[model samples]
Target: MTKLTKRDFIAGATATGAAICMPAIARAQAIVLRWADGQAMNHPSPQSAVKAGLEIKEKTGGRIDIQTFPAGQLGSSRDMVESVASGALTMVTEGAALLGQFVPQISIIEAPYIWRDPAHMTRALKSPLMDELNKVLGEKRGMRVIGVTYYGIRHLTSGSRAINSVEDMKGFKLRVPEVDTFRAMAEAWGAKPTPLNFSELYLALSQGAVDGQENPLPTIQSAKLAEVQKYLVLTGHIITPRLVIVNDAAWSKLTEADRAIVRSAIETASAWQDAEIVSQENSLADTLGKAGMTVLKPDLESFRKPVLATLPAKFESKWGKGLWDRIQGL
Candidate 1:
């Protein structure tokens, strides 16, 4: 090899410096991501999402800035998923129920009376079952699951009447998110299920378009459903886990380091959201009672067995055989 001259040495040093500065320059001109949520602005779902965005901005050194749109300012819940799937938006929040449409396996987690406690649910989610779901979503739907937040135990509230038993559910029209598991559960327990968007639920309830709707305790409080619906029946049908999703196309554009930062930020925020949910949900029943909504902790036994006896068999194909048993084992 020939000996290097001063000019060559100076040129090599300049190139090295430029390469070192490139990532920082790119960070300064970072991509702006839109993170959408259909829940109300003050709802913990959107609040947690905003925190995630802030964390990403900090952790990524301003390389990825996420902007949040809550309370369906962008559109309906389904609309947000479609937007992210098509890469029109960067992020979205979907409960396991909604995610079922995109990745059918996700719905199994929404099955009623499956988990004994929050710890059980969390363990199942961290197991291979969840790994399979991530694989299915990534491979089939081009969606990435960056975070999982606790959505709390969903209970039924009716504008029609107080339902203490499964027999009370007959001849009722229940508003369900457009998820098959919910529809199936409602039907099995003796109600006509009407699928509706989250943003439209309050109006539907108030207008008599649907007799009732089911949601987590925080959702009831945050959406102020107590204002219209009179009865809260703690059926505890679904303990939902909300997911923070990113468009795979947009995710692929990021550097590995940035992707890791995004994941960590979202996960940290997810934990915070879960804690917030536990805190908020603890007092929600009393709060609803004070809000003039009749809160009933009914004998869920009369309701649970009917659905368990039928819904699982019908839903098994969509959720994969043995999935329910696997979840229980977890």
Candidate 2:
């Protein structure tokens, strides 16, 4: 047997304590990220986010965790985006038009009539154009695009008017998100755009503050707008693209392997979300009709022609020359 000095006794005690504390320290230091979005908790958009976060944790062997705050829980779309930009929030999934305040040209993704349909918009999202825009966004705004999901086709709903043609929109009070592109679209359609926070839209419609509003069918269903709005006109004016953005600071902290895992998980979630949204959109018209809203399929060409003439020209300067053409070509 070997005799132990006081120094040896203290060293053994210290070693045992560290052995017990190390695992707790590692667990506490796990990379936890917060993701915020405006969609409701039950909506496919946020559900997909939760799914992706789970995948990322599993793939990373518990190194990273993403916590999703949906349904404007963190704040409005603009507020959440601002939080991500300032590194106060880790990530956000929001409309490209809202993000346009940071990278102006990205708004083109949500411009009315820019896409023929959801499938066309999906192709454009996968095109090199998105790469160019993503680079610009990261460089200029310190946000990186990790995934793009197809937000459903936007349509008009009303309480007092049934919008069947462009003339019907003239002087109509239409509620729009506080995005310049949405306002521009409303103007081109001949409606008086009323910029309002989305959370306030239901009340705005119910109180007759705005005569009508536009959003995807899924949003109408999730937000229970059918209870307030009387009509659903399927103008399909815009096939909006939803972007998943990570603050550059948060992204930079991950290793290349972990980054790949994160990106892959997000891409998987986005694909699933796209499919789910399209599926929901397919059936929501009937669902809304059952809920007491009159569904209308108007002369879509009447809506398309005016927007094509005005919007492209209006945004081309800020969106860069020929970018619209390239997107169309895609």
lDDT of each: 0.83, 0.86
lDDT of each residue in 1-330, candidate 2, tens digit only: 123333553464366446656777554656867787888887899999999999999998888988777877667789889878987678999999999998998999988888877778888888888999999999998998998988899999999788778889999999999998788878888899999888789899999999999999899999999988999999888888899999998899899999999999999998899899989998999999999999998998888887788888888888999998988888
Compute the lDDT of residue 235 as modeled in candidate 2. 88
lDDT of 1: 0.83
Cα error, residue 243 of model 2, in Å, equals 0.2
Q: Which one is best on TM-score? A: 2
For all predicted structures, in order, the TM-scores are 0.89, 0.90
For candidate 1, write residues 1-330 as lDDT tens digits: 123333543464366446656777554566777787888877888888788888889877787777777777667788778778877677899887788888888878877777888888888888777778888998988988888889899999999698889898898999999988888888888899999998899899999999999999999888889989999998887778888888998889889988888888788888888999999889989889998998888888888898889987888888888888878777
| Ten-residue region with minimum lDDT total, candidate 2 | 1-10
Give the residue spans of candidate 1 off by over 4 A. 1-28
Error of 2 at 45 (Å): 0.4
